[model samples]
Target chain A: MNIMTPTPPSKGRVDVDNFALSYDTLEGPVEAVSNASIHVNPGEFVSIVGPSGCGKSTLLNAVAGFLKPTRGGVTVDGEPIDGPGADRGMVFQQYSLFPWKTVKGNVEFGLKMKHLDKSSRDRAARTLLGLAGLTAFENKYPDSLSGGMKQRVGIVRALATGPKVLLLDEPFGALDAQTRVIMQQILTNMWQRLKISVLFVTHDIDEAIFLSDRVYCMTARPGSIKAEITIPLERPRHQSMMMSSEFLGLRRGLMSLIREESIKAMGGELNDLALDGLSIDLHGQSLADVL
Target chain B: MKVETFALRREQQTATGPEIGAETSHVRTVQSPAGAPPQLAAYLRRWLALNRRGLRAVLIGAISLALFLLAWHLLTENRVVFFIRFTNVPSPSAVYESLTRAMQDSTFFTHVVLSCRRILFGFSLAALIAVPLGLVMGRFRVAHEILFPVMEVLRPIPAIAWVPMAIMLWPTNEQSIIYITFLGSFFPILVNTLHGMSLVDPVLVRAAQCLGAREVSIFREVYFPASLPHIFTGLTVGMGVAWVSLIAAEMISGQFGIGYFTWEAYSLVQYADIALGMICIGVLGLGSSALIRGLGRLVMPWNRT
Candidate 1:
């Protein structure tokens, strides 16, 4: 179900050192995450899973330098994060591909920002597009592509900058189930090839387990890490492997952690899918993509 | 809950339905075309079916226009309309003859070229100023705060009302007319461009930033293009306004141009020349608007696909 390949030399190591984030809403100061520490080793794939309002995305945003930490700090390769930079590439849950640009243009945007010459930028963009099976659609706009295709382009665009770390915030949440699976496979393939550090934020336990070497489960509002579960499943994951005993055990472990936190956060607001707790009966139920 | 079950079942059906429908459609499409002419006929049938609504709309529009023209002809030529009497209005045939005669006249060409030059100059000048101003105002709160109030005050005033002010403000009558045209188009273009820039998705901005674009780069790559569709909307609207105001200005202030020609014809009581002038303005307006639309299509390649 999984195949481990020889790892490439690790280039990016992300360290979230007791990071905390808060927002000043109309109501007052609201803490989103507090004292959340996580380490992604070089070439490691780590997923942060949590309930609604659990600030998993907040952590990812902090790492991406989109939000300032309230307490501790995030660093990439020993450099303290300040603002957004090309060193950390992020793919949002929303397909953020520039509508005006062709697929190639969007992909080459990062390269252009780095002041890469025209020929090299084109070569790099063409290479990534080919990697995503979108070389033929280079001239097409983002609007013309399917949701999955757009997200794939999003990933390639992030990768084109040759960033040391790739940050994903529920990248497949918008896609259909079949397409989601396909994208997961494509992402896994790309991750294996590039061997860049990945900090994935997702709500789906299965997706977290499927994609990451370790999964960090966060508590609800005033969010912080509740549990860190190591996914012992081998690399190069296949869709069929999701049904395996190891995968199910890991999913069940993560599910109970999330259910407990969600029940506390919502207080009987948990629907049947959430109420099902750790059962596999909720498979294909189309639960909320967020939270 | 029952709702969850229902939703899951519906999703399953929709998911499976497309696969089955696609397979059958593929087979049917392959089997349907038999011979060359038959295949061509089938292709045309498909094309017609796809564009049936558009074709119907065109047909309806043509019929309405034809009916209106017929009514106009009957009313003016025979003076047979129930409530309205046609006294000064020329018959359609007389107007047509005048139109043909005007088309052959060198004076008509001079009038047309002069008016076009004035419009092109003013419109281009307005666009040159408005587009960047709008983008800046839309992008920066400080710029917006400073400009928004002034623009709002000016936006409601009619372009014709600017006639006296424009005349006093500019040295020559021609410059004043151009200024009036500029005033007519400027607000619409600026307002629409601002709206478009504001409507640009914040996610696109964030995505661009994450990809390491600085402020200028983000504006060039994201804000400018994102606002283009709205900008074109403004351009077309502004063009129409520019023409209307251009005519008014030309009639009031000029000795040549179509607007002056038409006003001169009306004063002389030559209804045929008046009709000819109206027709020329209408044709030119249509052509210019169509040109703007063509430019819009050229710039926004994403919209075409």
Candidate 2:
């Protein structure tokens, strides 16, 4: 929160070209991402969606510079991905908060990394926590937090750094369905206010279409972008749009892309959450903010 | 059935031997069966597990002392095992008298103070240096590679073996004792600290790092707290090793410590006095270790689990 010396204005234009990653296990090399090209504009909320084991998370990881691509890699703004640094803040699926640090402490950790004074950090942390409705839980540890609360803490921690882009890897995957919807709405609300580039990965297509400017569908095994569907739904996406036919049709289209990938990739795993019945609730957010 | 399933069945069949035997034994012992006693035993087992090695050791000491006293009284009275000068060895009452006498000696307290000062000095120094250094090595693989090899080469060398070097390097004889004690406990604390540092979750580190913290800041903020449980462990272990090496250090370096006093008693063939001194050392070491463990509990309450 105490970013006293702001970084010389961040460009926030994140781009990936021919991004590839593989892990050479004893069995053989498992190619996680392959020749994946995507661009997230300055303030675009783009979500990458695919079936399980489709390397959507790997794509997010490559953007975060956690994994170096064997062939081509990612570039944030203009700089080449070297090592994991503060320029791209990542929200891990596990809500990887330092269990010892409290919620505010975790949120303020990145700010402190910027070497801001304790007081400034505290103030900024409070503001961010307030935005996420986590101000009351500033001093609570992640272990004490519910799955949704921890994800909120995770988001605050990522956002606290004031990084150019926020990279999320299935952040709400572990939450209950009800909590997931609430968290998604909270995230979208925060994203609307922040206006920062977000590269979110999820297995849920409805979530992808509901929250993104564009949704990138990935292929399995040697993962590459299978399709990029521009979400035509107007923003700020209200709760009403979730019930609208246009939103449902857009959701169906994204699901179809994922279903095709799922059939080929997740051969045996049951797909119980059918396309026809699944619903999205954008919470009570109105059309005033997203645009 | 198939041979594979038949073999599996046979293995499973033999697994119930202990339970079956216990059941049969219970049947023979009691006219009727009740589950109460076994359940009570399980509760008692869990209770003991919660108390740990210190409590177990204390119980053993009490039992051994009781048995030893009972045997001493019996043997001396009946002359069951005729003594080669039972007077010199002393009976339980005589030993008590000797203990009192030793306590009354002004020189005895001096020895204790001197030994304690040496131990505190040596162990504290070891802890202060090893904790930070080990933390550095543990947190970074590069640091681990750079520093661990030298530490490994030095770790196997006994603390007592440093006596000659300590004496030569330091001007004062007391300095030698402190050095010896420091070296004795250094590696255990270092190793444990390193273990504590090394085992801190990488996710936690990254979580901190990606927030905007520099690499150095990550080590300071994340690695330090995460490594505390291990660091405290190292402190406890280092204290233990330091105590073990303290006597050797005192004997070599002190003109007036517990070790020297014990040695003097031995040279004079005062076996009963020597035994008393040995008991005092055991009591002192046990007390100090308990203190460290208590301190650990205060600082890292999470470890109690």
Candidate 3:
């Protein structure tokens, strides 16, 4: 079988134009995303940033073709998204490596599915294990890895098949603050090297600012893109930039937008704003009203 | 700084004074209680209650056995119970002697072999059939739907109910006994197997899916290994059931088995021998169940919880 036969010309590029998603819980169809559109050019790193439960993960899954939008569509290259396939790889927050297989075996999994020869698969697995900074730990099981290390292997396992694009669902959300920063650096280095089209979903605002070439800021429930902030900072950026004035300005503006939306999300509450010690005197109107 | 300083000096003097008044206020005489051994004895009582299942079991078993033996002794020695003749019953020491005499004869080993052979055969058969069927039922909805109802119907029926049916169908004594034992143990194995297989983490399935494991191979490689703990559970339960059913079947009809021997001694009014056989059966049942429990621990080494 030909590996590249009939692959759509724009297969590496993903476009979700006017996409709307809803989930039916015990109550009713909860509208998650509406008229949300984002473009991820091939080999670009983009992050979707929002509050928890703002449908960022649902959107990622929609792109992964695990869920269908109620309206609009997601297309890769020029092909309409249908269902999950080998071409798209997903790394979940929990590092869902099969417990029964070792890290090496987990990385070798996709190649095994392709029925690759043992020697070749072993060689490729070794390379991926090294790329993930888990070379010596390949034979170790996922249960033994730290949260950061586990996510590394999770990312590596997804990349094992050489999927053109990678989908990360809160990929480092479960790690401790210190460990999370380290993982972010490790992932940033790994992504720069791999150059795979990455669409990362995260709730951490700072993480979004740090990793994304362009960050799509989303609102509360019934989510939509409130703003798209482009990082003009140079590539191969370091942690030192995180404390710079330019970084702080972007951070402050993004946080203000988030806080205003959060207040609006609670239905324009008056109590927190009216408490005597803390004054809310920004033009003497609610933040949402001003917006 | 004048009167306030004088008040501060007074407070400091009081604070610096001895704290003995606070210390001795709550004391009481714990020595007043009858048979109380003081502080160390109280600690010993607390320790025993807080931990020690063996102590609990021993206390309960001792009380139960005392009541049982007292009743037995009364019924036979005082001739209180009308159903059994005084001659048909024996004192506890007489029964003990009969147990020793039976041990000396050494014919009991044959009976033990007969029962164990039947149980092992049936239990193994049940495991063979139930484990695979259960794996299928757990993995495939169609298989579960087709077989689940049939098993539910058969599960409630007692093993003794199948005896007449087994007699007619198998046409051999040992085959019929094995059949009854197999039927008795089969349902627990099947149900536990299905429970174990289905209880596998769905996240594991998804992980395997995203990792590119194909359908049949996925079940073989992932689902099967994950279900091992449950499979072992079924086997252990089946082992116990097989023992229970085999003995019950032997008691109902057998020329030579521990169960049959008990029944024969009962008819001949060898009361001591009958008591001795009952004790043997009880001990064997306990010993076998312990063995299965040991096997369970070996299989699930990660089950610290």
Query: Which pairs, if any, clash in model 1?
Result: none
Per-model chain B TM-scores are 0.85, 0.73, 0.72
- In terms of TM-score, the best-performing candidate is 1
Give per-residue CA lDDT, model 3, range A1-291, as digits (tens).
Answer: 322232333457889999898878999888988779998988878999877667888899888877899999898776898777667888998887776678898888878887888888888888778767788898776777788888888888888787777899998889999999888888888778767788999878888888888889888888899999998777787888899998889889889878766655666454564535466556777889977
Docking class of 3: acceptable
Off by over 4 Å in 1: A1-8, A268-291, B1-38
lDDT tens string, model 2, A1-291? 333233343568888888888889999987887678999998889999887887888777777767788888588878898777887889988888887678888888877767788888889889888888888898777777798999998998888877888899889989998898888889888887777889999888778877999999898767899999898888878667788998899888877777788877856443554444334343666546533
The A-chain TM-scores of all the candidates are: 0.89, 0.86, 0.87
Measured against the true two-chain complex, the DockQ scores of the candidates, in the order shown, are: 0.70, 0.37, 0.25
What TM-score, over all chains together, does every model reach?
0.88, 0.74, 0.73
Q: Order of candidates by lDDT, top first? A: 1, 2, 3
* TM-score, predicted candidate 1 vs. hidden true structure: 0.88
Q: What is the lDDT of residue B305 in candidate 1?
A: 45
Report, for candidate 3, the interface RMSD: 2.9
For every candidate, what share of the true interface contacts is present?
0.91, 0.73, 0.42
lDDT, candidate 3, B1-305, per-residue tens:
34445665665565556652344557632222223223666667777887789888999999999999887887777766566577557777788888777777868778878877887788889989998999999999999999899888889998888888888899788999999989988988898889888788876676666656678877876787788777877777777777777777888867778888888888888878788778788887788778777876775453424
Better of 1 and 3 by DockQ: 1
